[model samples]
Target: MSFTDFFAIDWSGQAVERPKGLAVAHARAGTEAPEIVDRAWSRQDVLEWLEQLARDGTRALIGLDLSPAFPFHDEGTYFPGWEASPVDGPALWQLVDELSADDPHLSATSFINHPHARRHFRQRGDCGDLFPPGRGRFRVCEHGQEAMRLSPYSCFNLVGASQVGKSSLTGMRVLHRLRSKLGLWPFDPMPETGPVLVEIYTALPARLAGMRKGISKIRDRETLDTLLAAFGSAPHRPLPRYDDHATDAMLSAAWLRVAAAQSELWSPTLLTPELACTEGWTFGVP
Candidate 1:
């Protein structure tokens, strides 16, 4: 008998072919050589591959750049909010409280209650339908849908002292690791903590302008800054103004319309962004 395996990792914002993909071939016994490489991918690219790759009794080793042990800062510690925990901590509970205060959606209680809250957590929740009665998948419900949808958002306010490098370093390190996993460059493991000095490169104004066409409205500084940075440069500007009610209404309406339409029948966003925000379900995964 011979065996084969597949390995893949997400690079940048999408998945790229990994060198390990070509490594496995039908073999009786012998260590297969590892192949590593990095390639860019769009959302559609990955979806097509997944559709083709899903098959009976086949498994692919997959990796993502996102933190795996998020919300698990210390084995004995706990946080009430924020899925992404600091590599180090000022006690997990206190950290979570701070995150909860900043971002109301993040909560330790939610992590415990939600099914897909852990990044690396794995289990076969629907395996009962995949067996022959009690032995193999001979009689199973075909209409039973597996896997539940999840919220794709989390936000926080920058507090008294700016932890400017904190987010930047963490995000960049994840990006770099993705690149490395795809064999795009030499592997660089970021020290779990420290002042990792780095720079971010992106067209701010252009990016914000693009989001505006799809956005219904803005709530916090982060979303506003992201939009303003992309819309136009306010030179020597400390922060963007967001108190104009008329502008909010316009943006809110535009954002809600698109988000609702995109959700189709799976999930529905109300007709206005303001209503959507107040409802705490601004977007839906259909």
Candidate 2:
């Protein structure tokens, strides 16, 4: 079964109800450049939009810029030494949702502040006692990403500017709420008849677009359109101020449209049945 539409969501974990950092872009099954879905979006807005996709019977591949699960293969447990540490990806999502039940706007700040869960993540100045040493624990697929000369960070680190911990936890809330309504790749298997959401690392496409490390973020329409053209897509309409979030979304969407038929991406050498179930694979990491 082939996908007819491709969507890439640049998600944010800011405290606001509608994060300005959140952006969504769509690309159809052709060479036309993908366009950003211009609007301020709350996490709820994205959830509802995806629900609409299913209702409309859209055959799409949705990509979100976040890790679907924290590292599970390292040390054999997510929270290691903690009895309540989740054993797998879906359970981790459920645990984050349950712990962050009171967090407003589908956020995960509450989970970050939880006494038990709090002990596993690094904060602005405090390194959680449980956070692994020496660059932190990495999922098996992330090692594959590293093998390809792309940098991959631990989803457990929350302190630096590039940290994905908070955002990823917030994503878990969405995944938990979204799984019943739509198929989540790896975690739910590739559904034969519906949209499937997969974890995406924008750097993968940026590198493929000829971007170098430390300069992957694009801030101009000219450079972005240049990359789009390389993907066999047209130029996107210019935003008032170009940002990495929008560019990442646009580029990934276009690549998804062009690369969806590549069987190697679906069957990566590093991806295993256990990792598919315990630590979800990034869609383009092969």
Candidate 3:
């Protein structure tokens, strides 16, 4: 079944009162351009927006710029040497939800602050030494990403700008709440109707749009316009130099508008059952 709309979200994991980098964009069927749905959405704002869309029976394919699960298959589990590591993506998400049950508005501070799990992330200076040499950093999907020439950072690394740990951890809280309301790709089979959420890496679409490697962010209107035109989208108005969040969301939505129709994106030749069940595949990964 084809989706009636496409949506892409640029998520932020900052512990701010209101997230500034979060952006949302959408493209409806038959539209030549994708529009910015929300340029400054908070975590709670996005949750309510998605809930409303689900209630409205929107048949949309939602792409979130965050890892849905951590490195599991390579190490056999997320937490090495711990006997109680989650067995799969759903189990891991459930564990995060349970641990962060008391967090307000789906924030994952509780889980990130937990004594047992906090050591896995690199946010705290003392936690970096907890991980042994190089045993538990990447997942099978990440290895595939490397094969495709994309630099995939470990979700456990929360230090550098490329690190996705905080966002993925916070996204897990939202995913746990939305699991019953929306279909999560790879973990949950696509439903006949309603919204379906998939993990997306914006760099894939940016590269397809002719952006150079190591230059992931778009800072100029000309470059953004060229990227949009590659997807057959209409010309967009001028945007600021630092609006990478908006550019990522808009271009990703435009890319998904075309890519979602292809069966290869949904079922790649390399997608194994183990990878699909434990470490979820990025929707547009080759």
Q: Residue 192: error of model 2 in Å?
A: 2.2
Candidate 2 lDDT at 100 equals: 89
Report lDDT (CA) for all predictions.
Answer: 0.25, 0.86, 0.82
The order of the candidates by TM-score, greatest first, is 2, 3, 1
Residues 58-98, candidate 1: write the lDDT tens digits. 33222221221122212321222434543332222233343
- Which TM-score value belongs to model 1? 0.21
* TM-score, model 2 to reference: 0.96
Query: Which of 2 and 3 is the better model by lDDT?
Result: 2
Clashes of each: 18, 1, 0
**Which lDDT tens digits does candidate 2 get at residues 1-286?**
5999999999888877998889999999878889889888999999889999988878999999999897787677778777888878888999999998988999988889888877887788878887767788889988988987988888878877788887788889988887778888778857777788888988898889888777878999889988898789977787887888888999999988877888888888877888888898988888
- As for candidate 3, its clashing pairs are none
What lDDT does model 1 reach? 0.25
Candidate order by decreasing lDDT: 2, 3, 1
* Global fold similarity of model 3 (TM-score): 0.93
Instruction: Name the 10 consecutive residues with the lowest summed lDDT in model 3.
Output: 127-136
